[model samples]
Target: MKLALRKIRLVVHLLYGMWVVATRFARVTAQQRLELNRAWSLRFLQLAGMRLVVHNDGARIDEGALVVSNHISWIDIYVINAWRPTRFVSKAEVRKWPVVGWLAEQLGTVFLQREKRSDAKRIMHELSEHLVAGHVICVFPEGTTTDGRELLPFHANLFQAAVSASRPVQPVCIYYEDAHGNQSTAPSYIDEMSLGESLDTLLRGTPLTAHVYVCDALAPGAERRALAADAQVAIEGALDRLRPVGARVRQAAARGQAEQDAEVPHAGDTPAANGPLAQ
Candidate 1:
């Protein structure tokens, strides 16, 4: 009964949120739009019975910063935006989603077609321009959502935008925890799970908490691949700190090996390179 009530509230909130975004977002200043986005994001999280807990180690997210994080679910976007309004680099398919798509467009998301090799350059250029305009651009370098158990290899392509614009890259780590404070799989938007299914799972489950850890920022001018590798290490380290005692020891050993592997380039590896934008 309570789950059903929450679902109904979520639907109503979505309707009202979309209306406000569609109407007032266009006329507002950048700062105003950011505040509106933050407000709606907070409400969205509340409707889903999720609490956002952010841990920043004194690292500031400056304007023209490239904020990169590990992806767990669709709600990851809102969880991050609830704290800091950023221009997200999302897949092109997100632009076709129903009400959510329209809201993302209004929030200034940069949509990219992943199947098209040429599209990367176009999106990179777009991101660079946004950074030049002093906007914080966020990207999920994992390129897809994970189950919140491990970190995926960060793709080096999009990091080039920060290099092109000479913007610092901030690494952020996110985890979903249950009422017991253990890592939760209830919120994982993994294989074959529709957005509706994910919503139902959360709505029926206990309130979940999102942990956002902001790590040190990598200075501009490093090659994109190196930057991506460094950011991955930072995020992996943060996740290690969040793990249970026994798990933390195992994860630390694995992470040390991974860091060493990242330092050794494969024979086919090349320096950061950006192709011309698709015409």
Candidate 2:
């Protein structure tokens, strides 16, 4: 009964968000839009029974920076938004998603068409413009969701936007935990999981706390791949530090799974691996 009530509230809140996007988004200033996004995201997290705990080593770049993070679940987007609102780079198909898609478009999401190789260049150019305009652009370079035990390779293409705009790259690390402080994979949206299935899993779990660690920004170097590599390393180190004893065990198991998966050439591995838009 409690889970059902929470689900109802989430649906109503989602509807409210859609209404706000349809009505007020057109008239709001850029700063107002960011604030609105932040507020809605925080409320979404709260209603989902998740709390955000952010640890910043230093202040985030104010003038505009490319924010990169490991993709764990769709919830990762909101957790980051709850900390500091950022315009995200998502795949083009997300623009066609039901209510959420329309809201994402209105909320300043830049959609990338991943099918055509040329699209990456186009999206990169678009992202560069956003950064030049002093907008914080966040991308999950890992492209797809992971179980928070490890980070997949960071696609270096999008990192070029920051280099082109001469903006810094902010690497963020996120993981979830249950109320008792044990690492939780309850938020991971991996495998062939449906959105409804993922939500149901979360609704049935105990209250969760999302940890967002803001690592130091890397300078806009000459090479995007170099930047992406460095950012991935930074996030991996952060996640390692964030893990508990149980999580380490899970990580070792996950490593074995990764190795086995790598040996098999699956259809899921392709350019599209880096194309998913966030939740």
Candidate 3:
């Protein structure tokens, strides 16, 4: 909607969060901040009717780790943010979407104009700088959202950020479980749904349970792409194991399979919804 008006609310939230971050709960180190962030994320998910299933093998995801997850909906920001404060590397157009752009600014998210072919280089360069600086970054390697059933094929380019900065990239998967405890099969798309349409469609219905699974982190190196692929597989596998087999999940799998056949969003279909998400 109104971009100007949306920014105002973000400013308020930013100030409030900043106060809490800087004063009430002062942390000694970045790692400590991460711990606090995770606790907060857990609480956020609880309020959102979501649960986090983390399979952390004592793998400490300190300052130099990049979290890459499957894109599903705008809620991913809130889901991850509940766990930790992170910088998002997103499409440049997101900087104009009302309150979302303002929050991205406050959260130190970097936005690149994906509409231009050259923006990729700029994004990589920025990511390299941030990763080297020991900043925590979260990216959606799928580059787009899907029905919450299966992980889309990994976008290899986003994995390069961790390699460029010698940081580990972790894979995380998120899904929705309805009241009956059945997992949601699919979700809204930015290009396919606007903020109003999305909220209307989502809120009008009964709330669904959200699930976030954090898998073991991967090492960043020449095999970054391979790691990304493995992470996607791991998330999908974990999701499958957590929930029972359902027809929606099967259909979602088929949709992903068909996309691979046609090749989807090579680099420039990213749309701006309201924030650190797809259109």
Best by lDDT: 1
lDDT of 3 by residue, 33-126 (tens): 5566556555544543456544443553758788887777876777777655688878777788765666566557888776787888888889
Q: What C-alpha lDDT, on a 0 to 100 scale, does residue 113 get in candidate 3?
A: 75
Model 1 scores worst on lDDT over the 10 consecutive residues at 270-279
Off by over 4 Å in 2: 245-279
Off by over 4 Å in 1: 246-279
As for TM-score, the candidate ahead, 1 or 3, is 1
TM-scores of the models, in the order given: 0.87, 0.86, 0.71
RMSD of 2: 10.6
Worst 10 residues of 3 by lDDT: 1-10
**Candidate 2 residue-wise lDDT, 145-216, digit = tens:** 988877899989899899999999999999898888887888889999998889888777659999998999
Error in Å for residue 248 of model 1:
2.4
Q: Candidate 1's residue-wise lDDT over 147-226, tens digit each?
A: 88899999999999999999999999988888877788787788999998988886766588888899989999999999
